[model samples]
Target: MNEFLIKSGIAKGEGNWYSRLTSSLYERIVWQKLNNPLGYIALALPSLLIAYIVSKMGFAIGVVILALIIGLPLTFAAMFYLKFGISLIIVLSFFLLGVKRFVGDVQLGLLMDFLIAVMIFGLIVRQVQERDWSFANNPISKIILVWVIYNLLQGGNPSAESFLAWVYTVRSFAGIMAMYFLLVYAIRSEKDIYFLIKVWIGLTLLGTIWGYVQEHIGFLPFEMAWIMATPERYALLFQAGTFRKFSFFSDPLVYGILLAFTSLLCFVLATGPFSKPKKIFLLAAGMFMMVGMLYSGTRAAFILPVAGLLFYGILTLKKQVIIAMFFAALVLGVVANVPSSNPNIVRLQSAFNPTEDASYKVRMRNQAFIRPFIYTHPLGGGLGSVGEWGKKFSPWSPLANFPPDSGFVRIAVEGGWLGLLIYSALLYTVFHVGIKNYLLLKNPKLKVVSLGMLLVLFSLTLANYPQEAIGQYPISLLFFVAIAILNLSVKFDRKPELLHA
Candidate 1:
């Protein structure tokens, strides 16, 4: 029987066929090793160390070291495995740290650290594989490259301090690219996109609850740790020893931005293809986010949720609702403008009137003084230059004591007009891709995602005019990811599933 089978060529020989199959299996096993858990641990070790240090040693020290560590191989591994995981981790950690100097200060530093790690990883990846630099043809990247070169030229000889600062600035721009790549690559499937949205939704709700509890009950559990660690600022804010809510975010602005973004997501989910119970839950979350936004006391914070609703209404063909929203917005604006006995109204008026307001005037005066330097320098002062210049060039400037009030102005001052142009172009591309996808896709699910992302991007762009929105890791990461997802969809001609209306 064996001879007959062999002669017929049905089987070489029973043992021969078995051996070939085994050899093929063995070769595959040798060539493509199964992912080991130890590898993940090794990769995450650097980030874990940073997290540990931040938890134990406070933010300033932790952030510097964290940045250094992230530039290493281990943390790079974790970031590679998860895709946007490192960015999300650092952002969430920053949010957890809140306005307490340890947390807020560390957040930026950690972001820098993560970016350094990503750059190192990118270099290695480029070395290992032949990458298509066609993506570099992106207008936004070109603009940023020009901006960096301009900074190098204008800044004169790049000393260690200047170089490091330049590195820091360039890293921020590169980090945005890394985020974009990660999103496009990792979120190929609708399931992955949905999972990310769920994570964002949960975090939003948690942030809102934290803000609510801190505001109403004067209870800040984890957040108070950092506040207590740095009691000086707490003392300044505390009137009658009552703590104003920073929530688990760096400041009220951060909290407000988070709420605004989350509320936009909630609005999308509530109106999208979710079940009745899920929709109800999302509606409740949206309401909670609105309450949290009001408590955040960020004047520009209202722009996001309001703009989101406006966009959604317009997209859904609800013209009357859009009109109603506009009227409501006008009423709110008038109320904010009115001189009132209420302290909140007084604060609002001060914020609105930049000329008479101490804070607003200081910001304007600093900008006016910095404008000439920015124009002449062309490249920019450097990445850390804006903050450093504020301290060195204009120590008395209000911005020296405070953070940059506007993201666009911050980039323009630090990276130059080139940087600003690049950033703007990047944002414009996001909107363009998002809108294009929305128009092209017949599927309602894709349309909703596209519209939601577009709304977030638009809201963020508007918010950037008033606050430093781009530098905030969570929002920036979210913005890039959304754009990447849309771009990928367009490239591959993949259609998202339709929602049952």
Candidate 2:
């Protein structure tokens, strides 16, 4: 911590690079020593111990396999999170939290959130230490600041019966917004953008692999137990020889929606102006996610890539390609929906023919019962008024018992039409920013990224109509990360200059 030792410790003038890096003070600096094999061993020793503790034994086959699966990435993230903090948290937020009681029913979401909080807290402490107070000045930062305030104010919602529900639901809002700010703060260059995209693809590929295993191989005992814990959920998943795979996610529906959006993202990345190897990898990743999407049995999730690419075709404005894509999609749609005994296809077909779907009819009936109340309570019933959080924390509320099948419906029920309008405006503003940046920026990579982002946002918006894709674990984290990337990619000029790195 000595300033003179830090500044005069290493020389920048022409010298032997090896000697410069291996200076006495540099050797004393633990972080600098981490560049060597000795430091790697030092770090790995502790990590091995932690993994052993997590597995409850040092070298059991299951435990070893699990440790090998996650330990490398966990250690990598730990070593580099401070430097590449936003990207690390965004990736880990989805993959780690979806572990689904890996620690004997102890949820990892809170643990992940705590880690993120500590990362941000360190950033805050650094800013304070350096007397630099200029990190959160961007337009995106302001928007997120407003959102944090809005969600915090929701605790005052009169209809929120239990403080616990408010706490439970509002944390997602707060956490996602915090992630948004962290991204706005951390992404300082094109390299950071590339790093984020790389990480996104890697996480998508990993999730797809886990989803594939759940579909084809098997599930962990706790995962199956979670399904069997609820009779209705189990029945729905096991219907007619179809076992919808939830994988590491909390539910199959959420899993499908996540994969559905990632399919669009990877598909776009594949077709983008990236390298051939990356493009091929992305194409494979897209196929994995697409397959996972199909097996998820969340019929509503199918529209995401279809809708995203349709918008993408319009953006391209290529008459032939547009025409071909539209017709191809139509043909594929017809084929996928062909009257077959395949339960997956039948479930998908029901999305197109909702009237024949009993669940759809029941949802409509449920909507009729709640529409009048939403109309009257323009603001909303309150946060946590419906859904799992509602049942747990606000069971006394009428909306608590009633199921709001769609994301928009849940928002409308909780915050009323007013809340819906605000949320929609927030989402549209994001799309508008991405589009505006795409049109204005002349950079080819930026254009590809921006256009892809516009489509991704569009896809998520459409998916929200059916699945409450946002405001949930993994999905919400991924959503905000995407938003952050798109926002960061923009070429903003209103400010004279950025205040901090």
Which candidate achieves the best TM-score against the true structure?
2
Query: How many clashing residue pairs, candidate 2?
Result: 3
The residue-by-residue lDDT of candidate 1 on 159-241, one tens digit each, is 11244554555556556555554455445466666667677778767778878888878754555665576667666345333
lDDT of 2 at 409: 94
Best candidate according to lDDT: 2
lDDT of 2: 0.72
Candidates in order, TM-scores: namely 0.69, 0.80
> Runs in model 2 with CA error above 4 Å?
1-83, 129-140, 492-501
